[model samples]
Target: MNELDLIQQLREGDEHAFKTLVESYQDLVYNTALGIVQNAEDAEDISQEVFIKVYRSVHTFKGESKISTWLYRITVSTALDLLRSRKSKKRFSFLQRLFGDNNEPLQEVPDFNHPGVALDQKENAARLFKAINQLPENQKVAFTLHKLEDLSYQEISEVMKVSVSAVESLMHRAKQNLKKILEKDNEE
Candidate 1:
């Protein structure tokens, strides 16, 4: 079915349509979330949240962009929200440990192995992901969508609600930042 037909069915609360939509875009949503959040479990949670948000707000979708673009925006926002909440929780936990009676040690999260990466490239991919994670939020989003998700500048602009030139600038800055970050890592 065409996107408009799918949207129409979704607006009418058709479960089958929703299921089809989920099946069609689940990989895209999950991969985008995984790329940003860098954890399989967190990515799965964010992907579910993205679908819920889509279901709740499908009626508000004005068809200003492609359905895929809308889904991309939702996935990015949901992943970022989860990341921010995780950061805040970690900060709160640290403060609690410092001030209170809690004696639990913080566990280190292992490096995420992206399933799409080749076996030989896994180590390099991990390092790249670490560098990407250090980027400012906007640059990170642009870089992930462009490099990982293989999105065009126009598609990223639509998803980010920014101009194409702005997306280009973000990608350029992201590449420069990644180079510096990787070089610094190597020198250490």
Candidate 2:
């Protein structure tokens, strides 16, 4: 089905349309979330939440952009929210560590298995992602969307609500940042 037809079906509460939408976009959603959060379980939860939000708010879609654009916005926002919540938890954990009563260790993310990467490249991809996690949020998002999600500057501009030039700058900075991070890791 075409984009508008599928969107109209979704808005009209067609179960088949919803199913098609989910099946069509789930990998995009899951990969985007996984790239940011770097956890399989969290990415799965975020994918479910994204679909649920789409189901609940389909009527509000203004159709100014494509449905994929809408999905990108929602997925990015949801994934960033999860990261913010994790930051908050890490802060609390820091506080707990600062105090005398030590309950548990700070959460450590295991090496991510990037679905898009070749088996031989998994280690390098994991290192890249580890460095990526340390980047500032905007840089990280821009990089992930461009490199991992394979989005163009124009598409990223649309999803991020920024100008195409801004996306370019972000990509430049992200690349520079990643270079520094990888170099540092290699030196160690």
Instruction: State TM-scores per candidate.
Output: 0.95, 0.96
Candidate 1 per-residue C-alpha lDDT over 1-188 given as tens digits, one digit per residue, 9 for 90 to 100: 99999999999999999999999999999999999999999999999999999999999998878899999999999999988998899888898899885778887878778999999999999999999999999999999998889999998999999999999999999999999999999999
Give candidate 2 regions above 4 Å deviation: none
| Clash pairs detected, candidate 2 | none
Q: lDDT of candidate 2?
A: 0.92
lDDT of 2 by residue, 1-188 (tens): 99989989999999999999999999999999889898889999999999999999999998899888899889989999999998998898889888956778776677788888999998999999999999999999999998888999999999999999999999899999999999999999
Alpha-carbon error at 133 in model 1, in Å? 0.9
Q: Every model's Cα RMSD, please?
A: 1.2, 1.1
TM-score of 1: 0.95
lDDT of each: 0.94, 0.92
lDDT of model 2 at position 105:
79
Can you give the lDDT of residue 176 in candidate 2?
96
